[model samples]
Each structure stands twice: as structure tokens, then as C-alpha cells.
Target: MNILKKVILIDDDQINNFVCESIIKNERFAEEVQSFEWAENALDYLKNTAVQQPEAFPDLIFLDINMPGMDGWSFIEEYKQIPEEVTKNCCLFMLSSAVDRKDIISAKSLKEVKDFFSKPLSPEILSFIKEEFICS
Candidate 1:
């Protein structure tokens, strides 16, 4: 099933971004995938793209919780201010290696986050998300 037309990966780790991007492409999860090493850049891109070209907004976003400038949590705080047109249709998922319960609880408490997942996104989890959230 076609779940996403575009997907974005916001992670500080270049290797993780590469792997995630490859996975999304190889699994045909999205027609386009954009990876960013900085959350600030991704935020700027999202806001600008929404105004300049709303059609380019991603349908799905995988955000890492650990980063230098703006962490995943901070990104969400700022992201909430963006126009609804830019975020309404996008599904936000927190991607991190942190297993802290507080983090998971915090993630779930946020309305913007659809769900939380451990790092190294897998096909099984991807399929599950697509089936549970996107396909349904």
C-alpha cells in the first residue's frame, strides 16, 4: 500500500540518516526521502517548503531525540508553531536509542508525536506503523 509520498529523517548521525533513507527507499516506503544532519535545518526546510511549496511537505518524519543544537523534544516545541498546513498531514515519530521511560512517556504525552521507536528503524516496525496508522 502507498502510505507516504515523502519522508524526512532528522538525525545528527549521518550513518543513521543514510541507513534510514536507504531503508525507506528500498522498502518503497516513500517516493522521496530527505535526510538532515541538523534539526534546525530540517525545521527551516519544513517551514520554508510549506510556504514556498506545500506539496513538498513530508508525509512522515523520523526525528532523533539526541542532537547538538535542537534535540527532538526542542524541535517539537518549535515545530508546533509552524502552520497547520505544514504539519497537519505529517506523522511525527520519535526515533532514538534512549530507552529511558521518561523519554517514552514524554513522547507519548505530546500531541504532535504519533509514536516513539528505538533507533535503527526496522522494516517490521515500519510495516506496523504503516498498517496501524497510515493504512487504516
Candidate 2:
């Protein structure tokens, strides 16, 4: 079964968001792609919608590590507080340009974060995620 129906992109960088959104849409990886420049807004959206319509939650979330407000780390922390019904079925991936070893280790340690990827997510990575996480 195809598990990617809706996807949420939380990155403050517009260029990154544009590129990622373009790729996700062009490849038909997800039926819907919602890009947010602020992680806080994304969180609020999920918080409000997940309860009112649990199925409206995105199947996948691509989060950026650094932002002016509510960085990815902060987002993850806040994400944990959201209801389980909103987050239980979805996968979260850290998409960042930072290559710090400490950052990598930190991301891997988080149960909420499924994986980490360098900037400009590739189609191959998405395919693998779909096969390994979604299809299974």
C-alpha cells in the first residue's frame, strides 16, 4: 500500500522548502505537500487539526534543524506533547544542512526522529523511506 498521502515540510528557508516541495510533488511521493516557514505554525496546525480530524495529519514530516523561531529540536520537544493520535502513525525525518557529529548523534537518539538527511532531500532517499517505513 502507498503510505504517503500527505506530507508536511517545516523549514524556515524558502529556497529549501521550494526545492523540497517541488521534488516531492514532481515525483508524486505525496498526494499533498504542505510547506511551512515556521515550525510553530506547523505544530499549531497539527495540534488543531489532529484532534478535529485525525486523518488530516500528514503521513510524513520533513523538519529542519535550525530556524529563527522554534528550531527543529524545539519542534520535536513540543511535538511530543501533542496527542498520540496525531503523531503515532507518522514518521519524522530531520532534513538539515548541518553536518555536526553531535547533531547527528542527537537526532539519532530521538525516538520521534526516524532518520536524518542532508540538505536537498533526494528521490532515492524518499523511495527508500517509503519502502522501509511506509510499506512495512
Identify the candidate with maximal TM-score: 1
For candidate 1, what's the RMSD? 1.1
lDDT of 1 by residue, 1-136 (tens): 4458999999999999989988888888998899999999999999898889987889999999999999998999999998886789999999999899999999989999999999889998799898988988
The parts of candidate 1 lying over 4 Å away from their true place are none
90: Cα error in model 1, Å: 0.3
Specify the highest-lDDT model's number.
1
Global lDDT scores for all candidate models: 0.91, 0.89
Reference-based TM-score of each model:
0.96, 0.95
Lowest lDDT sum, 10 consecutive residues, model 1, at: 1-10
Candidate 2 wrongly placed segments (more than 4 Å): 1-3
Question: After best superposition, candidate 1 residue 117: deviation in angstroms?
Answer: 0.3
